[model samples]
Each structure stands twice: as C-alpha cells, then as structure tokens.
Target: MKQLLILCCLCFLSAATLAQATWIWYPGDYEIWLSNRMQNRRTDRGTFFPVFWKMDSHYPLMDFHKDVTLSEPEQVRIYAEGTYNVKLDGQPFEGTPTVITIPAGKHRINVKVFSQATVPAIYIQGNKIISDSSWLVTYEDKEWIDETGKTSDITATKWLHAGSWNFNDPAILPSAFTLPVKPMAAVKTENGLIDFGKETFGYVKLNGIKGKGKITLYYGESKEEAMSDKGAVNVDWLTFDKAVSQDSTLPASKAFRYVRMVTAGDIHIDNVSMLYEYADVNEPGSFRCSDDELNQIYDVAKYTFHLNTREFFIDGIKRDRWVWSGDAYQSYLMNYYLFFDKGTVLRTIYALRGKDPVTSHINTIMDYTFYWFLGVYDYYMYTGDRTFIKEIYPRMQPLMDYCLGRRDKDGLMEGQVGDWIFIDWADGLSKKGPLSFEQLLFCRSLETMSLCADIAGNQPDAEKYRLLAADLKAKLFRIYWNDQKQALVHSTVNDDVTRYANMFAIFFDYFNAQQKEAVKHTVLLNDSIQHITTPYMRFYELEALCAMHEQSYVLKEIKNYWGGMLRLGATTFWEEYDPHESGPAHYAMYGREFGKSLCHAWGASPIYLLGKYYLGVKPTAPGYATYVVEPALGGLQWMEGTVPTPAGNISLHVSTKEMKITTAGGNGILRFGSSTRPTCTTGTIQQTKDNWYELSLSPGSTYVINYQSVK
Candidate 1:
C-alpha cells in the first residue's frame, strides 16, 4: 500500500514536469506581424519603399485559453503583450490580474488581448498549469453575450494550437525580438568615406561625433555606389546639435560594404563601425576538395546563403529584404544541406504562407505559389515532422483551391492581370499563354497537397488531390510533351521549348528514363535553346544535370560560372552573374547603378548541389529513418563533407581509390560503383548491379570500403 502511494506521487510529479510552458500566440499571427515590420524597413534612396502588393496585418483581437484538470490548486503568473483582460473559468477577473489563484478542479483559463500595431501574445507560468503550444488560441472566439448576461454558443469558433518558439523566459517578450549583432570595425577610411572591406548588413554606429551640423551618409553595396550619393539605395540624414561627443547608431539596418559620410556646418566624426546582424545558426555542413577554386566557390556560397538567412529566409540583404517564396524555396533546400535549422524553415514557410484569405499568389507570382507548396513537401520529407504538416495542411488546402479556381479554360495555370508570371529573370521570356513550367509546378503542388492531406488525416481531400494531381500529370505530358523536339515545350502558345520545364521534369521524376535522356540532350545541352541566366534556374538546371550523372560536367560548369564570380572579386554571390558583362556594368541592374544584390540567397545553390548530389545523403523515407548515401567524386581527386539530417549528421570522406562513411543516425544504404569488387569489413556487401556494390549501414557505425577506382 505504501509503494502504491509512492508510485502515484511519482506519476503526479512527472505530469507536472511535462507541463512546463513557453510564450504562445494565435498560430502564425506573430509571423505576419514580424514580416510586416521587417519588410517595411526597406528604404530606397532615403525614401520609404514598401512592397507593391497589399500588406497584411495580424488580427487586432485574440483570445487564448487552456482547459486544465489539476490535482491541487495552483497560483499562476501571467504576462501579456497589448491591452488584455483575464478570465478564470468563464468569470472575469475584475482587472488584468498578473497573478491569479484557481481552485483545484476542471477549469478553463482565458486571456483576450487587443493590439493594432503588434501581435497579441501571452506567457503564463505555474507548477501544473502553464502556457505553451498546447494551449488553444482563436482570433474570433465569438462568445457573444445577450442583455440577460447569458453568453451565446461558440461551437463554430475555430481554435488552433498556439504558435511558439524558444521564447521560454517570461521576462523576454516576443515583440522585443531582434537578431544578435557584433561590432565590426571598418577596414579602411578614405577621406571621410569608410569601407568595411566586404558587403555587409546591419546598423552603422558613428563614434565620438561632436559639434552642430547636418551629416548625410550614403550607404552602398559597392565602392562606386557609396560615392554616388544620389544613386545609393540607402541614405541617412542626421542633424546633430550636440555640445559633447556622443555616439550615434543608425535608426535602421542597411546593406553596405562602404559608407560615405558627408558633414556640413562644423560636424566632425572620429571612427566608424557596424553591428553585423545575423541569425544564430551553426555551420554543421562543410565541403573541401582537391580543387581550390571549387572550395572557394563553396565557402562564398555558404556566406551568401548565411547572410540572407535572417529573421526569415529573405531574398537578399541589399534590396527587397522580403521573404520571397521562390527564393525561400531554394534557401530551404540549401538550408537542409547546411544548417538544417528547422525553426528557420518553419518560420519562413509560415511567413510566406500568411493567413489564409487566399488573396493573390505568394509574392503575387504564380510559380512562387507553387514553390511554396513544394517547400512544404520538401520540409516534411527532410524533417519528417508530421505535426507541422497537421498544423499547416489547412493553409495548404486553401492555397491549392485558389490555384484550382484560377485555372484557364483548359485547366492550365496562366497569369492573370495582377499575377506576376515570374518563371525567371530572362529576356523576352514569353508568359502569354498557359506556360508549361507553371503547369509542371502546379501539378507537383497538387501532388504535395495529396501527400500533406494524407498526413493531415483528411482522406477524402487526399483522394481528391491525388486524382487532381494524376489528371494534371497526365495533361502535363499530353499537352506539353513534344515528340519531335523530345522535350516539354516552353509554352502551349507557339510550341517553343526551353530548359525550365525539361530540367525540372528531370529531377522531379516526371519523365521516364528515355524521355529524360532525350530532353537532357535536346534541351539541356542545346545552347540554341535560350540559356538560363539567373542562378535561380541554374539550381534546377544543374540539379537535372547531376541527376543524369553529369557530375563531372557539372563540376566544370560550377567552376566556370560560380568560379567566374570569384575571379571577379565576389565576396558573396550576385543576384545575377553574366560573364560577358564587364567593369562597373556588372553592378548595374534594373537600369540603376549598383542595383544588383551581391549576396542573393538563390545564388547559394552549391550548398544543395554538393550536399545532395556529391555527398549523396538524402532521405529515402521521411526524417532520415531510412536514407541513401552514394558519394560522387565529381572530377575531384578527393572530397569530404557532412550532410545534416533530422536524426544527426552523415559524414563522408571519398577518394578515387576508397571511401569512408559514418552516420550518427538512420539506416543508410551505401551504394557506389567500382572497377573491381568492393570489400567492407564492418558490413556485408552485395552486388546490386555490374560494377556496383551496396552495403547496409546502421546508426553510429563507420564503414570503410576498399575498391579499385572506376574512373
């Protein structure tokens, strides 16, 4: 009898421990609020430049509640942002009570808050009753009261699990969130102008400034841009009447490697420095090889990607610091191979897929909307977190419905008036009719919807989406596939064929082997076909090549293209790189001086290419429960790197003669080809095909394979 009592006490203690909580908000409300704050910070030539499309806001009023059945009475401390009212078990707490005592029983705690400028959020703490994502939150609780003081039914009101991150401490509010920063001194000062030696982002601080005067600071991503006061994208004008020397920090963060400070009326400054603001993510993935140029390209690509991975995965640091869906889609892929920061990926996905009124497409682009769906699909595939899918699936349904409603007479996606048909930033790219590329992406998105619906436990919707995807896939081939050309035509308009659809088809596995090989030669290698210019399309273009086992050829192309940027003194990759463009002409884009961003997120494709294709570590099943590791030398004498998975890291070292692999988690199949039979002492090797061998690998095991180099 005493032992039974002790077991009951232990179980009670465990239950209390499991109730530890963190900050909570209406799911995705904080993301929308924060994105608005971040995107509105853009300044062009000292003028406020905001998005051309309609901006969204969080619900001004929100109600959060949690039902608890406690073993004993508990005192709970409450903290909230915005004007709020507290209620205990459907009864009002006279005022906004910071501390409330509740009797032990089945009870519901509610906090309703209103804020026009910020998101409504709350943090609650107690021994057994605490606040976290487990709490239910609703923007419209709909508990209307009548004249008799009787509340109406709220059965129609929808409640979702509250959204949260690592904001566990009640002392720190979510509204006060900011990226961490560090001081960086200028590399050199040239007559009133200071250069930070490389393109950077963050607020600039002026140290030891004295006297009364007007100071104008021009910010630039390039040396020429800084000197061009009128052309600089960001500028700061400050009027100082200080009697004593005071340090001043800029009001907003700007992207610039150089700053030109022009002072008038006896204003003087001592030194210049900056607070380099960045996301706190560790570099778990690394790549090194015999080729120095490739290594340099990889390092610069990593830096470029990291710089753009801030509050959300933005497009670039210099201009339009917005969470673009298509750009973020690539960033997600690159992130999977690099930081594998699930928080950032989830944050970005939520921000891009803002609240579900399903107005215009994401970023007002058709292809981008499709990319958003694909991003969600890839997120589930890589992380294997079904909870996110369950939470996000509702949003996905409406988005797919929006696309379905917009289909043309033939049921293909075509650009409407407000929709931006941004396939790529190519010259004279036809977007007139229902482009095959859009249909291809739309088909894939439907497939994603089907997969997510299954995970979200909506079997009817899953079947609906599956049928839609199947029908669309059939149409994709029937309508777009051209036999004589042996490739998917660019558009149904004039039967023009481009690399976009064909390349995407290759990696998406939309094409069979015969069609894939045919398109690989006819479209990919066909220079007569309009060459893809942006690194964005190049990502898929190269992925298609690597998929076709053209890694050796891709190695040369990476060196020529990415390496060309390095030869041109690129501290980070460019928004677009054209080798033919010479001198300052390289800096000019959008018909403006220094308009091109030097650190674009989409340019960091090598992170994905090397990790997935070279290291060959990809999840066969979700969450790395089952995976495949097939390393490719890609013309390198030796290469080594780590690919991050939800389970852990898969490390690999490969040379021409032998290969070594170690994984921290997951069951992996190590497959490779050799001129002779490969020998593995730690595991049994089987001949999968002629000159190919496969070994089964378990978690935390290292395997060394001795083989004669096939190449």
Candidate 2:
C-alpha cells in the first residue's frame, strides 16, 4: 500500500509538471520570425526570389514575468535564448541563474532577454512552478534608472499573454522548428526521366552520385514542360567534384511530379528519390456522397489546400510561398471544414498583418486588406475565441484608421497612388476609380470592426464604427445600385454593370429578397455578363447560389468547373481553370510559358461549400453554442459528413428516405423538408415552413428521422 501510494503521488506530480511547463515569447513574435524564414526560401531557377512587399522582424528585446502564490518553497530550472537576466520580487540576482529558489507565499519572477537574429523565448519548470501562457510578456524599453543605479523609473507599458505552441520539450528550441519530411521513390523511371506519379513538393535526392560533372533537373507539373528547357519554370543546376559515390540531396524544396534529367561530362546517378515535406495538422472533419466524381473533386481539393498550408497559408508551393490575405481568407474557411487547425489560422493572420505602422495594404492589394478583416470576423464566429479578438483588436483599429484616412471627400475608398485595387485576375477588369466592390468590402470591414470593438470592450468605438458602416452601406446602394441592370455597377467613374458587387451582396445580406431575385436573373445567370474563369471568384459565385437555396445548381457548377480540371488529369487543382483552353495552353498565364500555378489554395473551395451548404451545418451563435443543420441532397442519392467547431464535431447522415444527426455540443435544430409527414425516433417535430419541419436537438442524443424527399 505504501509503494502504490508513492507511485500515485509521483504520477500526479508528473502530470502537473507537464501541464504547466511550456516555452513562451512575446505574442505573435515567433510566428513573424518563423514566417520570415519560410518566405525567403522561394527560389526561381536558382536565383534568389523574395517578396516585393515590406517584411517585418521580431522584437529584439523581450521581458517575461510570472507572479505566483506558493504554499511551500520551491526551485525552478531556467532556459532561454540569448543573454538574459533574472529578477526575484523586484530584486536582481547576481547573474542569470539556471536554478533559483523561491520563498513561501507571494512573489514575482522576471526574465529579460535580447537576441537580434531570433525571438527571445524562455522555458521554466519545477516541482510546482512552471512557465506557461499564464505569464505576461512585453517589448517596451524600461532602461531609465534612478540616481541610485539600483532603482529604475518605470513608464506606462502594456503586457500581453505570452505566446506559445507545441514546443514543450526544452531540448528543441522554437526557432529551430521545421516541418517533418519522409523519403519517397519515383513511381516511374525512364531514360533520364522520372515521375513521382502525382504532384508533390520536396527536395530531390540523388542516390549513388559520384565523379565531377554538371547535372540539371527540369521540374514540371506536366510532362511536356519538363522536357522543354526553355519552358520549364523550375530547375536544379548542380556542379559536383566528388571522387566517391554518395547520396546527395538538393537544398531547396520544389513542386513537381515529373523531372527530365540532363547531365554533361561524367556525372552518374544510379537512383533517384525525394524527401516529401508536409505540415502536420489534424483532419477532424470529413465528407462523402453517392457521386464518385464529386467525391474525387473534394479529395483533390483537400490535397491542394494541404499543399498550400505551410508555415502560413500560401498561394502555392511552386512559386511565391508568401502569404496573401485574399488566398488565405479562402484557406481559413476550408480549414475549418477539413483540418480545423487553429494554429495555422492564427499564424497566417499574424504573418499577414505583421507589426504595422499601417505601411501598405496587406500584400499591397486594396481588396486583400479588407479580406484580412473579413477573415478575422469569420474566425471569431467559428472558434468564438474571445481572447484572440481582444489580443488582435489593437492592430485592427490602426488598420481601419488608415483606411478611413485614405477616403475621398465622398467618404468612399478609391485607388490611390501605389495602391493596387485588385478585385480579380480577369483581362478586362478595371481599377480606374472608386470601385463599388471596394466600397462593399470596406463597409463589411467596418461592420467587423464594430463587432470586434464590442467584444474588446470599446463601446465608444463600437458605436462610432456601427454608424460609419450604416452610412457607407446606404451610400453603396445609392451610388452603385442600377435598377435597369438589376446589379451594382462596377465603378462610379464608368457606371458599368458587373457581377462582382451584385454576387457579393447576395451572401453578404446587403440585398433585399426582391433585389436578390432580380439580380440573380439579370447578373448572375445572365450569359452576356463577362463569365468568371478563375476558381478564386468561382468560389464566391457558387457560394452565392448556395446561399440562395440553389445548392442543386451549384452542385452542377462544381461538377463542370472543378470536375473539368480533374478530367484534364489534375492530381491537384489549378490556380485558375478555364474550360476554353486546351493542350499546353491550359498551363500558360501572365505571358510566361508556365507562370500559372498548377496547385493553388483558393482552388479548394468545394471543401467549404459541401461541408457548410450541402451538409448545411452552420453556427447561428458563436462557437456552435447554437447551430442549425439543414442538409440539402442536391440530387445525390445519399450524403454524410462532419463539421468542426470549438465545441466538437457535428456529424450528419442524409439520404432520400431518412436523415440522422449527432452533435458534440450546442443547442441545435435539425431542419428538413418532406413532402410526406416525417416521423422521428425522438424529440417533437414541428412544421416550421410549408414543407419544412424542425426538430430540436440536444448535445448527446442521436436523432434519426424517416422522411420522404421534397423537391
């Protein structure tokens, strides 16, 4: 009995230690430093390529502190990066102490550190005292000392909750983090040509390489591009002077499935392999349906999204791995449905909004700036992390202030010098004046600011922004709404009717029922309007239809558009897919032979659409505290899937004859339409609409219903 008691106490102590000890740094500093290392890694044909926009660095100095009340005296082990000092209850130690003893009762511990090349971070652990996010951190300067030299003058400074991630082991530093990689071999090998059989991103490995010679590998998403020296967009040129045979691997990672190898002199490689590098994230949500082709599209889209999800959600793995707000906005929605990885979403938001004096719009694009705000709005609704909203509110105000400062006399946003008003990548799209689309986004951002301001406890600013948003929304309709076109015009300067603003207004809830019906016929379904070719915009276009209860029509668009790319042998979705182009012409864009990215993040919107619309699981309240599930078969024989929330997963299985659902948490309503009266296993069913019925759901109960399909 004595031995068992001792073992139990030891296990409890170990668990407590594990729970409390974690490395931490200034909030968002490690994310910025990590992204700096990841973004500068892009290489174009062996020439160094970096982002054109300004990049920010981590704070060189950081102060971390923790105040605790202890019942017994204890000692803590200290670990940190760079030169540091320790303080105990406002008293300085002789030097930085690896182990320090604390007295019983209340006391405070402070660690100050500085490092120019990396973020200053620390880890502390003990039997009872441990470093964790409960600690506070700041980067303010407090060097002004009193005449005594021991006492110091303090200035007003703000401290935030320290930031940390999965770096729990002290042996592994945060700055040394890297994605794990695994070895893979070619599926097919020919004379100087190799194919991995599908699209992949990794470093090339040459096995049994020897002698001194020149070797070059041309990478391609398609077979033809790899064989053409002039057309290949990515290449590896290596010079060797080795006397013995040994395996060699390239330094930089590239995206490719096929590689055409060329060598000069006596270079010889017996075999070829690759090291596939990928982000580690959990896929908590899933989807399946009766249609095999739609299932395949969802699978490929998930792959495409995972490829672009790296240190930050990037545009593509092949080129410009830098985070773009517009691309990441779509990725965040897709991630909520698939991975539900909160770390990636937060990291991408931090990396894009860097530490700002409000320099330029995120990615230097006007529309991208608004998308960042929109992403924040969605992040809160899905996760309901009020702490994150409070932390980011400071950055939000300044960015909004910058936007407000740029407005013209009309209180409207217009393209200014050095501002790129990028709405889409179409050929004839105009950016010449105060765009209706920009105004729409700006108004939405203001509304987001108002919501966040209320959450952050800034009631004055919240009311101010609410009124600002209301005024801009009214101006938007007056300036851009055209009765004849039944759509919002493209711009005030041209007064041209376009689909951009009208389609956005539908899902944004800016249009009335009568206006939405009119615009759907005259602008969305109208053939004369310039057709959308890029999957980026197609994401929203299809979403507009889905929001209007046109999931059946949107399903066909998904088949013809995303399915069209799959029919073209796309292992991963493309940056843009236009069914008009054929052969090598499908790969050409921006005047370069292979400038277009074959695997892009925004191309993966089916994950969001199917999970949210077809499955019809959405949060009517923050964090799924209250949610509604209204499944749409959309002509499918059967469909089933799960949608993730902070609470847990909401799973649903639906078919023509029956419907079933199980929720992890939240008060939910299972809604459906049955031409014949529906019967449920449990719960009271009430007819909510002419053909629709609603069933209240509790968290742990599994509700099954038998119903006949309507429509």
Candidate 3:
C-alpha cells in the first residue's frame, strides 16, 4: 500500500512536470484549475519568505575559525586565537576570558565561531547566555578538539497560547504541578506574649482580610536565643496566600507567571525566616538561529509557543513547571516553520501527537495533521524541494485517513468535547462544537491529502478522500445553509451567528448561485478594486478569507490587519491582538497565550501572498501547464518583488498602465494555453485580451496598470 501510495505521488509529480516545465503554479494559466490546484496544495513549511532584509555590517556578525581556548584569564590572552565578534557590553572582545558587561534586560547577541584548521577547537559556553528561553552552563574551554561539539546553549523558559498560532510545530501535552497548602492560627499564651501557630494538616482560609499582618517566629528556650533574627538556612517564613513561596531548605526560585495559595494564614512558629528556592535549570541548549543576521527575524516566539499544548523545554526536555497556554500553541504551529529545521519541527509534532485528546494540549490528530501538512506544503513551496514530501508524506497518510475515513453515522467527523471539529473562529460560541466552517476546513485538509494521495499514486485512497470531501461539502451546506438569512449560519443551531461562514464557503467554492451571491453581499465589497475586508475580524481570520479568495474586500483589510499586529505589543506577529491592558499570563488562551513576541513567517504570508500576490503587487502563479497574467492590485503604494518560483525568478511589476512580467533574465517565455479565459479590463493595468505574452523587461523597472471598474 505504501509503495502504491509513493508511486501515485511520483506519478502525479511526473504528470505535473509533463504538463508544465515545472511542478509549481505560474501566473499565465487557466484561472480555475490552476488556482484550485494551487490552493489545494499544502502550505509552505519551514522555508524563509521571499522578502528579507539584507544583513548589514551594523548587524552583529560572526566568522568561524579553528583552534581556541578560555580555560583561564592567562589562557584567554594566549592560545585564544579564533575569529572575534563576540560583543560583551557593547565592546568587541576577542578570544576567551575577556570581561564584558551584560545589560540588565535580556540581550540577545549572535556568536559565529568556526574551525577550519585540521586540529579541532572548542568554544566554551558563556555566562548568562539566554537562548531557547533558558540559561546554559559554562563549559570549560579546552585545547583543539572535535568541531562537532559546538552546540546552541539558549533555551525557552515559558510557553504561551493566544489563538491559532503555535510556535512549535507538531505539539505535546501541557504540564501540570501540585504544591502543598497549609493552615494557620493565632493564640495568646500564658502571660502577655502572643504565640502564633501554623498547622500542616488543618484547613484555613484567608478570606476578607483587610490590613496587612505578620507572624514572627521564636526558636529556642529563652526569648533571646529563641527570637534571635539570625538562624539556619532551613529557617523560613511563609507569607499570606500567594502563587509562589520560598523554602529555606531549597534554593531560590520564582514562578513564570502565577502561583496560588490554597490556604492563607496569620500563623508563624519556631524555625522560620524568609528563604526562597530557585527553580533548577531544567532545560538546556539554545535556539537554532542565533546569528545577528537572523535575530531581527527571530523573536520571543522562537522561545515561546503561542498556541497548542507543548511545554517550552531545552533540547526537547521537560520543564519542572507548566510555562505556556493553549492559545499560544496554535499560533506557534501556524508560524514556527520560519526559523526551525524539519527534524526539530517533526520532533515537536511527534510530542503533540502523543498527547491525550481530552486535554486542550493536543486537540486531536485531525487538527494536528491538517496544520502539519500545511507547513509541509509550505516547505516544498518555498524551497521547491520534494525530499521532505517524499520522505514524510508516507507517515502523514494514516493521520490524513484518520481524519477523513473515520466518520459518524450522520456523516460527520467526530470531534472531542472542546475540540474544534470543523468550525472557523467565533463558532466556539456554539456549545454544540465545530460546525460547517470546521467541516469545510476538514474537507480542505482532505482535499490537500487527496492531492498528496493522488500524487503518491494511491488511486483507491485518492478516490476515497475525494468522495469524502465532496460528501462533506454537500453535508456542510445542507446543515448550515440558512434560506431566511440568505447566507450560511456560523452554526446550524444559531441564526444570529451568521457571519463570514459564507465567505469561506465562497472562498472554498462550496456554495451555489444564491449562496455565493448572499456571501458576496454580506462578506465582501469592491473598494477601489476587488479587495476583501473584515471590519470586526482579526488578521489571521482575514488571511484565511483572502487566501480562500474572499477577494472583494481584501485591500482595505490588508494594511489594517498587518498594522494591527504591530499595534499590539508585538515586535513581530502575535498569536492574537493584545488588548490595551494585558498581563503576561492574561493572554488569549490557557496553554499557549498570545503575548508571545517574535513571530514573522506566517504572519508575513498575507502581505506577500495576499497584498503582493493577489492584489497584483508582484506575485506569480506557476501554472499546471502555462502562465496566466491576471493581476489584482490592492491599495499598496507600489510593489515590485521576485519570488523563487520553480520556473526561475518570476519577476512581476505592477503600476498603472500595463502589467509586465519576465522570467529569469529574458530567456524564459510566458506561455498561456489556448484555453485561457478572458475577463473584463480593470485596475491600474488594462486587462489584456491576449492569452499570453513573451517579453523582456529591464532589471529594476516596473510595468503599470490603469484602474478600471469591476463590473
């Protein structure tokens, strides 16, 4: 079966190649089939986006050299010979044992050390190096050694969850902890002294207490020695109820966010002094991308997960505490591919897959696999590499089948209690759980799976999924369509919930005439051109709408959505928009919250794909057979960019007269099959009547298009 699947996929790739010079979609092609196939293709994975800043000299730079040491101060001045660029406290300190200042707030610096000499060398771990969200140990700097020993020391210390974002791909179950709660009391003994006492077993609640109070402990016989302030390390005092507490017997420590006290007290006894225990350094190692060049691209998100159920641990190790929330996990999953490797991403996914379905930590296999493929497809898209798909697609088959093949008698995919079966955002209000939108997403996932299956040559499986997808779409309409509202309801049980469900239905092309028109009316508007807008929705929600071709309102919402991400306290994209006042823990979800910073990859997709690609800025579609130049320019000042398409550099230039595109240098031709459809003229560039054009454009020059009505 696996071999057949592999063969089918190979055949599909072979067929696609035979149909066109390359396997990717291009601009000049039949609109319907090309768009459908491209949309159905898996999303790009851990590949870098086309748009990137060229790292300048000012950016922290690192060069590699062989042979070095930092065993001692004297050793630092002598024998410490390698490339410099390790800046400590803003001063360039070469070699090892150099004194450098560490700013108060966490500062991320890039380190580049290489060894080319035949004899190997070692780079000792520096002090207070914060990578991957955790501190790394200081290793002894030794003589020339094996070069493979160089490893990242930074690690993550916390986890977040706001919404759809999951910083770590795949995912794992969340962590849990338990602490002992004690009770307390106050009693005036014998003469005039007040001897306060605490009980380890009894229940005591500190409710409705106004002013501050404290209970001092007395140790030995007489009040002098017994009340001596100086005592043993084991001596400690327990303040009122709090999320954290100090133990004299243990090291000093602080909680990531919150700590709760089950019981409160006015009691203190003997052996007691303030003592804090530090949490052990549980995880080790640092992030994969620590170079200054990529630091701008890397953000707190690289250290934290926005959504999903994975704990932030160094080197894939477990933490002593639960550091993230569910909301952050989802955001991470959708965005983490920007800076990580496939193996790292796969490891993270495997952890999440192993999680219990009951806990929000893992959700279900369907949601995980669906998003996983989205990332995998992205990997293929940006890098134009098929090895990952060829190697990993087989493993993904069973998960895809589980989501599609397993069904209820009612023809519905089974979702857990809090699990989102097939609904988009906002439908969570439906107590019944995942509705039409959710099912639509499932169908979308199946569609992608079927594409993979067909490519893999699993004809029986491909037919099975295709049929299932068709049936699900039909069932989605029957169940959620509202004739009275003239649109699809957010859920079958609610009419007031009528929202952008129809937009997705239209975007997914899952509707009929009346339905499509109803959706077009309520969901989109032609502002300037066919630009889609979502007034009350979040940016990601809008991206799905735009990606799904809710094209009518895309332009107006594009800038606002991207701008909104910046407005939040995000240096890059966030799991969700953080309201004006939000604490570290008070984000959108309980497991992976949104306050996580440093997300750029997926969040930047709409700008490139929607604003740049769809809005006719500078984007191309690699056709299944030929090129189709259909430009839709949203309201961007002007966009000129080149994406690494399978057909070489597909350069698209859009202005206000004629849209011009050139492939490679001018060596490539824009071929449009005879079957190309001709639509009316609109936008800055006049829509051409010809199906194809082969032209040469000067480098750094642009093509223009004049604005026209959409009627």
Positional deviation of 18 in candidate 3, in angstroms? 34
Candidate of highest lDDT: 2
Worst 10 residues of 1 by lDDT: 142-151
Model 2 TM-score on a 0 to 1 scale: 0.96
Each candidate: RMSD to true structure?
5.1, 3.7, 22.6
Backbone clash count, each prediction separately: 0, 0, 133
Q: Which regions in candidate 3 have their CA more than 4 angstroms from the true location?
A: 1-366, 373-387, 404-406, 417-428, 431-434, 495-500, 512-514, 523-540, 544-553, 564-570, 578-630, 658-660, 664-711
lDDT of 1 by residue, 1-711 (tens): 999999999999865685567888987888888888899988887788898766777888989999989888998889988899999888999978999998999999999999887788988988778898889888885654333324467555677889998888888899999999999999999898899988889989999989999999998787888899678888888899989999998879988888998999987788999999999998898888899999999999998999999989999998889889999999999999999999989888888888758899999999999999999999999999999998898788788889999999888899998999998999988989999999999999999998998997778888998998899899999998999999999888889988899999999999999999999899999899998778999999999999998999999999999999889888889899999999889888899888898889999999999999988889999899899998888779999999998777889989998889988778989888899888889999999889988999999999899987677
Full-model lDDT for every candidate: 0.89, 0.90, 0.35
Q: Model 1: what TM-score?
A: 0.95
lDDT of 2 by residue, 1-711 (tens): 999999999998776665458889988889989988999998887788999888999999999989989999987899998789999998988977899999999999999999999899999988777778889888984544332223344764567889989788888888889898999999999988899998999999999989989999999988887888988888988898879999988888999989989989887889889999999988888999999999999999999999898878999888668889999999999999999899999999988889879878888999999999999999998888899998898889899998999999999999888798888889889888899999999999999999999998888889999999999999999999988777899998887777888899999999999999998888888989999999999999988988888888999999999999999999999998889999989998889888889999999999999999999998888788888898999999999998988878888899999988988888998888999999986889999888899999998778889999887
2 against 3, candidate with superior lDDT: 2
lDDT of 1: 0.89
Best by TM-score: 2
The parts of candidate 1 lying over 4 Å away from their true place are 1-20, 141-154
Q: Model 2, which residues run further than 4 Å from truth? A: 1-18, 141-154
- A best-first ranking of the candidates according to their TM-score comes to 2, 1, 3
